[model samples]
Target chain A: MGIHLPSLLPQMQELGQALYERSLQVSAMIPKAIKALHSTAELDHSNLQSKIKKAGNRWTGAIPTEETLNLTYPPPTVPQSLHVIGADGSQIYPDRHAAAFYYLINIGSIVVSHGSGKAPTIQQESQLFFELEDLYDEADHPVQNAYVNLRRDVAEMKTLTKIAESLAGEQTLAILDNSLLLWMALQTGGSTSRETDRTLQQYLKLLDRLRSSKTGLAGFIDRPRSVSVLALIHLAGLPDDQINQETLRLTPFRGLTDRAIFTKLLAPGHRSALFISASPLNRDFRTAGHEVHFFYLNTDADGAVVRVEIPIWVAQDPELLNRVHAGILKDCQTTGGFPYTLVRAHELAVIPPQERAALEDMLQRTLLGHGLRPTQSQKALTKQLTGQRKQHTL
Target chain B: MPESPMMIGRVTRCSTRGFVGAMQISENALPVFGSLCQAEAQGGRSYVVGLVYDISITDDQFARQLAALEEVPQEQIADGQINRHVPVEFSALAVGFHNDGGFHQALPPQPPLTLASVFSMVSKDSVDFTSQLHFLQTILNAPQLPVDELLTTALRLSAQARPEEERERFLLQAGREVAHLLPQDLTRLENILRGLRA
Candidate 1:
């Protein structure tokens, strides 16, 4: 029998009811917490500042002044080329006796480049096939197949990376479908399934290769497994002051902004972390023997956004972080703003359907002025976009 | 009406020889038995005749054997003799045809007969009869010869039979026999059989 969405309607209804009730409870409690905070403001500030200053004193003895190395070159007029690759796999069992097969779709597109304020070249293409029979025995269960499929996905990623490397230029940005690296040093020599261990080792190896390559790798992983692994890695390398100050703070009331609270409490250069999505971490996260520093970026109606601290030791140098930040900022300006952020200019560059092609043409013209010749594929894409634009107008 | 015992013997031998001759025409033909049931006794004796022929030789040899069986002795038998037993068997010593006079006297006439000749005729006729019998046997054993093959084979065999009454009787019997079989299985078999026929 097919999976009917209607069958899940009752559960969804129940969840909706629960969420409604929970929201009401949070609403009632927030005002009480706000009132309490206002009454305790004076007493809390004096005590908290003293406690924070005492904690900060241990690390305040010496400030190291490292000369800022400038890698920023003269502004090159090359057209900004942004490439985003997102892959998704769906497993389907067509019949009872037939094996469950996975269909993996890797979608890659050239987004806007650094110098050109142009609309990104977006391409959506896919590949489909049956899962290889040799990868698993018929007797193997679904969970085992999940691990196998993950490894298959990783292998696909490696191939994609190679392609990205070949296509990548000095100004190119490669966005992975998932996390670029997984720390699994603690998983080494542990009593885990051989398949699981092998998958972790493969992930680690891929990360190593990506780091060594000239192409920059960024992944958009929505799953909790990837997030927690990132969080753990971030926490391990946290500067001491952040940890000491954060340890004493009360867990904020549920509806309050946890990230805001952490930010207020944190000393300059200190870190605070928040977990979003509430998904269980992937199995590899349990044993990824690495010290990670986690910093909570913000908490708002959109939920918490956090950053995983990549240790200078593993990241090889602190300059890489500076480069990453510079790259992100440059991408923001070139693409009209950061693609991942809610920055106003970035949103404007994402032209609505009706104006997409016209906007693309305008951007292309601008890019041409910067001496970037569009490839043949890009020309075909532009033609298609223009056609779509005409159709939308009609 | 009962024929003379000599005539009955002659007829039985002729029928048996005919059966064996037909079998000898095909090397792969299997030896088979034929049974004819009658309501009343013939010549005051109930008889069941069985015949077989071994045709290990080539077609030429088989034809020579059939020629010998046609020359069986009839003169020695008494007229209108009833309930008499006449058992005749022979092997080829020499074989020659009677020659007409062309300035020379005709060769002495002799009864030409061989046991192989009688056996060959009986076996050949028996195979032809038994071919139909085997079809019936398969229907009885398998009870699932495709309805189409069964009906088509029945129709073909009926068309070939000399007696119309007998053909009608067999056809009626086959219809009643197949009614007990599974319809779908029979239908599928029928389709397969139709393909085979085409």
Candidate 2:
């Protein structure tokens, strides 16, 4: 019988021999590598824990001392009137396909004095602007309204700056919603595609003027990237001695405990402002050096004003910071245990009025036992609507 | 009934035992069964039906058989029709079978009865031997498969045999077949094998 076979036998034999050799070599090597890896892992675990403990201790004692402070000059004279501005923006999405509208509210309040003592009647000014653009639109065309709004903000900022300059004696702090605008202006160096860049440049020039005049400029930006930019700018300007002690620093704290304790611990005459929302436990607030008050500003059932104290903290205080940390850890042990009040307040503050009402309703229902009443404005509005209905029927 | 006499070989010297052992060694080092017939008169025409028995033999057995047969002088032996029982062991090499009723054959027997025919026979038994060999060659020649993939496959196959002895033997055989095809790192191969075990 004729038997046929493929002619590739030699090659196959060669391959088989090679594979056999390699397998043996590999079989011999594995045990050793695994052993080494295990040993290294064990060592690393112990070392890591010790290092962490050491670092925590160092951070605890790291607060700057008064002796380390290098003041180029004494603190400037306190202005007669201190203007604090706060701006918030809310985006509204009606449907999946519809463009969203951004409603911006800029609230500027003139605080007469720097200390806890009341001095003069506060003059409050608020401006509302709307930008209608689809969020899902092409990146290039995404809401040209921001640029228009930016131009308006620049004009307002100039006016505010001029007002600050013209005032006989006042410390003006013009708070912008974001630091990106200022950072971009500083980096643009005159080359930009949009005409708004010119106004932004002017704003930057105004900021420089404020710096020269010793008018403190601070911005509360939500994004970490903006913070990084600010840190970089501060690093470039300040000397090494001032880096952590006076100029640039970062404090990370969670929950209301640290905030409250820190604020209480602040020297009685020292003034500190806190940024807080509804959920105090879940979110992280990053501040440096100075103390901040963490509180909730919500409307009552009638939409009247209501303020709830959550937490307050000065970042430099070790005792208060430790307490805040411990409180957060303790909170983690509970179920559905979030600092909900702060979170809700933040949500209400960020959301537009139409949506805020629904959120407020949900919050009130959930927190009914907490004794939070609706604001007087909400009650009055409801009454007015009902009264108008009765009058129309008659 | 008439009685019919047919020459029957009892395999007085079987190469199976020794040859199989040698083959096992070779395979481990590198990568790489008997029958009788009975005749009886059934019809008036004295028709003879012979039962053929084929013993499955490995490469080593085939080698032993050849070694045993070498003692007989071919010239002195009667020139009768010699019917050898064909072994059915598949060869690791061979191409596709043709429709002409003839399957792929083994390579020529090497000197001292390397039994190239036996190898060919074994190779032809595998239906996909040809295709598989072609794939292996392509892999080796062109490096078609990723090195990681090849290592993983090798390790998995190596891990399949449970006892250390069996695993070693299996890997040895497989390694011989694909030694040149493997990458240089032994650790990588071990890792793949461990992964398979896991």
Candidate 3:
């Protein structure tokens, strides 16, 4: 009664067929993309930048580095003894209909010492925001979810940096379970520009500290939907005069991701050439000397290609870059496709639904014990009562 | 006197006849099967003494997948065993209660509350509790338990709790109790008594 299953069947079948057709198209485009990558390997960086700028700052794509476009580096020599620290975060967003008006962020991290033959060290840090200043902004409105997510990202990065600093002399690589670029903070239109800028500043400052500590940092993105490389390939096939906003907007290879091309190109345990992200926000990151550079890595023989984003510092240092590449590849091999530390970190950070409910119950009880009445909105109560029962035809 | 009780786990579920506790997956020196343990109940006014009958470690989808791999690194194995949240659960059968500073060979008035601390009984306490073998009947009649093997293991552990010279005598007394508890079932009685030797 809730979903009208019979009515969904037709649409579901159509969706399946459409997906099949799209996959065929994507498969066909893979070779073209590869061809474009090879042909443009010698394309001058300045020429590509001029074309990107001439697109009226509308075209965002991968900006090629000195590395050839189609180059695939085999798994680098991973150090015999290395430390890979992964940090992930989970947050409970504030809900207006809930019994409380607050948010909670939990950052979980793991330090895996390869070849040490010892158990990995794991930690979790949780913080609750309930104070008036934390809950509301200067506009007297509750903080947005984007702001909470930004804070969670900051917390995760800070925890990683803290861990890495503690092992300053050791060969350590800190990995984040997200993109290194803080584009979400910059793109969230609802949040105040000043707040967004401040959060970005904090993130950049953390990167500075990490660089100073000489820690290798990377952001691992699984099954990335990014089309940065595909956008670049699209530009490769276009003439200089045709590289305008209208032409860039109507990409011939729409819905195609960089992963598909790399999956066909890179062998197992190999990585594509590194390129800097063309996001306008990266300009600010560039100003801060922490521009985000990324590459596609074939993590496994089954063609599991993931995007690995690193800072300019890591990309500039060959030794550090190799550590990031080899460490992540080795970590992926252990878990069958994804980094083990990131999976463990996510497991530690995730707050299950039952736990969230229990936390709410504890909060409510504490409030009542303190002579304060805590109650959920009527809407929330009705949903809870009905949601637990099976839907009836009547 | 007992030296000291080592807290092993916390009571997660309980009843008048038994209770279950969850231990850390990476807990070292886990209590062996048929080991004697106790849970504080009635706000520590009474202690429900139980014999550990079963200890199990459950695996999730992640662990099952990892196990299928040809090799897993030490870091990953450690992450799975120590960092992952899978619990090592154990079930204990209630056999007696310690109330008024005396051991009673009967179930307590109430089971321990959830989250009550459960501790392993020290050797002295184990010896004192099994001095009288009336708890054998409780073990034999408890549902969903390996009755014969449990009696054998519990009797052997209890016998070991006694002094070296007195172990045979203690097991002899326990064997007699098990025989009396299963009089009509000659095979079951023989099977239990056959395993009661120190």
Candidate 4:
């Protein structure tokens, strides 16, 4: 039986009250800190860079700032002729209790041609994995959904690269609605998934293809809660040695988000200064000439800050950067402050839970057709029997 | 050449009574309020012909706001309408059918199946279906439907379907059928006659 939520009303209210109080306190705390920074926090790029070099062995994720303490650009007007493509992926994880250990990934993508007045090309492709190679890593352990999802992301980029190649002109941008740092999930310090390394190589290869074709690639993370900006705040708050992880926990900006701080610093339609993320995952990109750098843009009111990440190629080139900015801003206008292509792509890609259930039914029917009896594990059967469903059956 | 957008919808629901069924349509320019729709039964062997009587625009708070929306620029209107799916459940009359290349004015053997392709049979095809006014009984009884509108359009199409010599005769027969069906609503009947005469 589930614990009764009504029974814990008093405790829930107490917790809610505490959180609400803390939020108010944080709200007050953040604006004051940002105001102080506006007056005193130098862009301090050189000092921050030297300190970063000094603390290389100790710290991992402080991003290097551009010239200004921050940079915010007004909303860029979209060019007359352009092509915007976006891809999103969703997956049904392999159920251990199913007939076979299998997973499925569905990628949905759209290509919107601006100034052509044509309906966007929307497509969804679903791939099923049941082979041994798909089920296991190089080290032979059964792969989890996380690894499969990363592979799906790689597949999406590969699809984008192919699409970009075919389009060839009119200034294109291919977007993924997630972080560019695919290696973040694979970096567990001691163990590196060789499969991930292979995927990374392929991902970077696609980045090169995209770059050669002049197709801008970006990862758009909306309403991001990242504290990448906190590193700068930490640098400003304490000395190099004092700015270690343990000391960072004690800083006043502990629970504050970069979004929260930037909300005050930036007006709507403005982006912050670029910062090269120093995460271990970003290091590989740096070596491969595609380092991941991010800048926060406030797309709408009520402090909506979306973090946009680009490879070093786009970041280093001003025209490409403007295209990325203008392209995204116009697309946002189409969707009321979100990427319209990404919205359509996600709608095409997301596999509903009912579809997964239907797939299982099909799998059972296929097995029965082959005269090979396949049954769910007893534990799975038991869970199904005991589960409460919003449906009727015998 | 493609003669007008080939309108296609899916059968959302159907009824055993053969009087009414609902088809869900999403088109930028929806089927005219009173039009003919046809559904192919399972295979290509049989078909169910229907009259489009009611168009229900699906609603929620969002759709309400959209409906209340005022003069938007022409370009924005084109893109904005993409989000306004507005699935129309046009209540239809199971008027007649064609089986094995033979046409019959009668109820469908069965209601259209769900998710079956529902095509808006237009132009001469619509004119051919309403050649007989037998479907008017169901149309008249459906109070929710616009009885006057359907009678007028159906008679007009049936008249157009005839040869020039028989056009007057077709309207006379359809008028008699309407007068017989609604003796009490004579004003409405007269209005329908005015529409058919036009």
Query: lDDT scores for all predictions?
Result: 0.34, 0.31, 0.88, 0.74
lDDT of 3 by residue, A1-394 (tens): 2788999999999999999999999888778777887877767778877766676665678988888878899999999999999999999999989888999999999999999978899999999999987777667788888888988999999999999999999999999999998867865455456777888899999999999999999999999999988788778767888877778877777878888888889899999999999898888889999999998999888899999999999999999999999999888886767998998899999999998889999999989999999989999999999888975696
Model 1 misses residue B174 by how many Å? Answer: 83
Better of 1 and 4 by TM-score: 4
Candidate number that wins on TM-score, 3 or 4 = 3
Q: Please provide, for model 1 over A1-394, each residue's C-alpha lDDT reduced to its tens digit, 9 standing for 90 to 100.
A: 3368999999999999998997787666555443443343333334433433454433211111121111112222322343332232223212222222333333333343333433333333344344554334344533333443554456545654565565545444444333333432223223335656566667655545545554444443221222222222222223335655463232334444333333334332222321212122223332343222222322222333323333222234434443333444343331122233212122222334554345346545765888875333555556656655432353
The list of candidate 2 runs beyond 4 A from truth reads A1-108, A114-156, A171-192, A208-214, A220-352, A355-394, B1-198
Top model by DockQ, which number?
3
DockQ of each: 0.00, 0.00, 0.72, 0.24
**Best lDDT goes to which candidate?**
3
TM-score of each: 0.33, 0.23, 0.95, 0.88
Ranking by lDDT: 3, 4, 1, 2
Model 2 scores what on Cα lDDT?
Answer: 0.31
* Candidate with more favorable, higher lDDT: 1 or 4: 4
Worst 10 residues of 1 chain A by lDDT: A62-71
Docking class of 4: acceptable
lDDT (10s digit) by residue, model 3, range B92-119: 9999999996999998999999989999
Deviation from native of the Cα of residue A99 in model 4, angstroms: 2.8
Error of 1 at A266 (Å): 12
lDDT, residue B64, candidate 2 = 46
Q: Candidate 2 lDDT, tens digit per residue, B1-198? A: 533322322212212111111122112222221111111111222211111112234334433433454342221111111112222232121112222333222221211123311221121222222223323333233233353444345333323423456555544544544544556867755654454445
lDDT of residue A126 for candidate 1: 40
